[model samples]
Structures are given as structure tokens and as C-alpha cells.
Target: MTDENARHAEKMKKIKAARDRMMETKTEEKGLIMVHTGPGKGKSSSGFGMIMRCIAHGMPSAVVQFIKGNWDTGEKTFLRERFADEVRFFVSGEGFTWEVQDREKDIAAAKRGWEIAKEQILDPEIAFVLLDEINIALRYDYLDIDEVVEFLLYQKPRMTHVCLTGRNAKPELIEAADLVTEYTLVKHPFRDGVKAQKGVEF
Candidate 1:
């Protein structure tokens, strides 16, 4: 073989060995509290991706949408229609806070959503729970952050993976998360006068 090809092979061998060693160190496994937040999009989308993974494994999962109303979306429709037996979906919000324009109503909806989330989290049969857009409710003080965090960190089932998605996640929630991903908004189509497209923004 050429000298360049020989050098490339040598470098890959070292990388594989290092990766194997690092993977070996990761032996302990437990349910993870994951937070997906920031100004960018895809927070809820990413949470759904995890739910799809759970479905692929035949693991039962549940979703409690805290801020989005009963709007038609591809993920919602597909999951509910195709995987009804493995996924339990709930939409607890009437609409966005700006649209609802009633603090009392928003709070009531958030509380109702939280109750549903708690049920899913505590269910041993459920392996994954997605509390979609729950950070918005927490940000607006529609729900008690302390109570939510306490229950998630202490009272959740040992093998249940819970994901919280939205912007402006509480500091306490971030501190309690086992995995956190912040979606940075470098650019967006909305700013360019492009409306949200089906299968992309919904």
C-alpha cells in the first residue's frame, strides 16, 4: 500500500483502541433525565426522536405536551396512528400563553399536564416519557419548578427516562439533568419571511 494509506490505517487503529477503552469505563447504566432547551428549534423534535427510539425497541413510552394545543402535526399523527399500542399521547395545553391570554387558564392547563406527566413518570411499564415544552410552563411560573424537579429527581421510577424540552429551562432542572443539549439559533427561516413548512416546522 501507499505510505499515505499506511499512515491513515495506523491513525484509525489508535482511535479505535482509545474509543474502546473509553467505552469500557462507561459501565454503569441508569435512567437519564435529559433537558433539551434554548432559543433554536428542534427541542420537541429531538424529544420525539427519543420516543421513536423507544418504540423501535418495543418499549412503551408516553408524551405529555405542556404548551402546544391540539394542532395537527406529522409526528403526533404518525405516532398515534402507527404506534398506538406502544405510545400514549396527551396534549394538555389549550394553546400558547399569548394566544390563551389568561393566566388562570394557563396555570390550570400546566397543572393538568404535570399531573399526566407524573403518572407517566411513575409508571413502571413506561420506559420513556417526553414532557414536551414543559419548560415554557415552568418559565411562566404556571407550574412549581421546585416540586417538578424534586419529583423528577427523587420520585421517578428507577428505569424510566424522562425528557424535558423547551426554551429557558430552570437552573435547578439543568442541575438535575443527566444530559443537556442547548439548541443555538444561528439562523431560521421565520426571520427570512418563510413560514413553517409541513414535515419541517410542525
Candidate 2:
């Protein structure tokens, strides 16, 4: 082989060895509390991707949408249609706060959603639970943050993974999370007079 190819192979071999060593140290496996937050899009989308992964592995999963209305979303439709027995989906929001424009109603909706989420989280049959847009509810003080955090950290099943998705996640929730991802918005088509399109938004 050429000198360049020989060097490249040796470098890759070293990288693989280092990666294996690092992986060996990560032996503990437990359900994680994952948070997806920030101003950029794809927070809920990422949570849905994890739900898909759970479904692919034949694990039961549940979703409780806290802020998004019952608009027909692609992921929702596909999961319900294809994996009805394996997935439990609930749209618990009346609408977005700006659209609803009623503080009392919004609070009621959030509480109802939280009840549904709690039920799913505690279900022994469910291995994954996605609390979609729940951070927004907590941010607006529609739900008690302390109570939610306590239940998530202490009351949820030991092997059930929970994912919370929204823009402004609470500090306490972040501290309790095993994994946190924040999306940063560099640019968006909405700034360029583009409307929310099907299969992209919703």
C-alpha cells in the first residue's frame, strides 16, 4: 500500500482501540431523563425520534403533548397507524397559550396533561415516555415545577426513560436530567416570509 494509505489505516486502528476502551468504562445502563430545549426547532421532533427507536425495539412507548394542539402531525399519524398496539398517544393541549388567550383554561389543560403524563410514566408496560412541549407549560407556571421535578426524579419507574421537550426548560429539571440538548437557532425560513409547511412544521 502507499505511504498515505498505510498511515490512514494505522490512525483509524488507534481511534477504534481508544473508542473501545472508552466504551468499556460505560457499563452501567439505566433509564435516562432526557431534555430537549432551546429556541431552535426540532426539540419535539427529536423526542419523537427516540419514540421511534423504542418502537423499533418492540418496546411500549407513550406520548403526552402538553402544548401542541390536535393538529395532525406526520409522526403522530404514522405511529398511531402502524404501531397502535405498541404506542399510546395523547394530545392534551387545547392550543398554544397565544392562541388560547385564557390563563385559567391553559392551566387546566396543563394539569390534565400532567396527569396523563404521570400515568404513562408510571405504567410498568411503558418503557419510554415523551412529554412533548412540557417545558413550555412549566415555563409559564401552568404546572408546579417542584412537584413535577420531584415526581420525575423520585416517583417514576426505575427503567422507564422520560423525555421532556420544549424551549425554556426549568433549571431544576435540567439539573435532574441525565442528558440535555439545547437547539440554537442560526437562521429560520420564517424570517424570510416562509410559512409553516406540511411535513416540516406540525
Candidate 3:
């Protein structure tokens, strides 16, 4: 073979070897915990997208809403109809903290919501659990950070994936997570008084 052809053949062999190694190391099924946090929109939306993907793959999922109580986004409504059995939503029912005007009440509602979220965590059959707005809950001391970390470490169910979404997620939660996504807010139309439109930011 020509020198140039020999080099190309050597590169092809290396590529095949790498591909074989990857295939050998690949797992058929695995579970992990992921956190999406930062001062940007679409955290919950991203979680919901993964939930849909899991549903497409016939995996069960559950969602627990911490801060959002009465604000039913379009995604929630759609999932209720399409993936009702695979999804669950636990709302605080207290609305926004400022709107509620009661710090203690917000914490109480958050604790109540965490009860349901914890239940979902223990469900081994549910392949995924999205803790929506949990960062804010932990930031405001609405949920116990140490307890949450312990649950993630020791109480995680077998073959269960978890996704926690909100701004400023707790450091402990990030440390315990297998994957973390921090969304940076550059600019949003909401700054220009644009309302959250359905099928977009809902």
C-alpha cells in the first residue's frame, strides 16, 4: 500500500477500535439524577420535554411542582391528558410567595408539596421524577436541604431518574446530582412586559 493509504488505514483501525470500546462500555439501561438551575426560563420546560421523551420510551414519570400552585401551564394540561398515568403534579396551592404575602405559609405549603415529592422518590417503578421549582424551595428554606441530599444519596430508587429544576439550586443538591445544567439569562421578552404565551413559556 502507498504511504498515504497506509496512514488512512491506520486511522480507520483506530476509529474502529474506539467504536468497539464505546459499544462494550455502553449500558442498556441506567438511571441518573440531573439538575437544571439558573436565572432563566425553560427549566421546567426542559424537564417536561425529558418527561415526554421518557413517555415515548414507555418509561413512567412523575412531576411535583413546588412553587407553582395554581398557575397551570399548557404543558401540565397536555400531560394530564396524554400522560396522566405516568405523571403526577403536587402543587403548593399557595401561588407565588410575594402574592401569597406569608412566608410561613409558603414554607408550610412547600413542606406539604415535598411530602408528595418524597413519595415519588421512593417509587421504584417510576423511571423519572421531576422536582419543579425545588431550587427556590430549598433557597427559601421551604424544604430541608440536608434531608433532600440524604434522600438523593440513600433513598434513591433503583433505575429511577430524577430531574430538579429551578433558579439557584442548593449547593448540596448540585453536589449530589449526576448532571447539572445552569441556564444563563441573557434577555427575555418578559422583560418587555410580554406575557407567557401558551405552548411557549406556559
Q: Which candidate number maximizes lDDT?
A: 1
The sequence of per-residue lDDT tens digits that candidate 1 reaches over residues 1-202 is 9999999999999999999999999999889999999999899999999888999899999999887775777887998899899999998998778987999999999999999999989988999999999999999999999999999989998888999999999999999999999999999988889998998888
Q: Give model 1's TM-score versus the native structure.
A: 0.97
- Candidate no. 3 TM-score: 0.84
TM-scores for the candidates: 0.97, 0.96, 0.84
Clash pairs detected, candidate 3: none
RMSD of 2: 1.1
lDDT of 2 by residue, 1-202 (tens): 9999999999999999999999999999888999999999899888988888888899999999888765678887888898889899888887778988989989999999999999999989999999999999999999999999999999998889999999989999999999999999999999999999987887
Off by over 4 Å in 2: none
TM-score comparison, 2 vs 3, better candidate: 2
Worst window of 10 by summed lDDT in candidate 2: 67-76
- Top TM-score prediction, candidate number: 1
Report, for every candidate in turn, its global Cα lDDT versus the true structure: 0.92, 0.91, 0.84
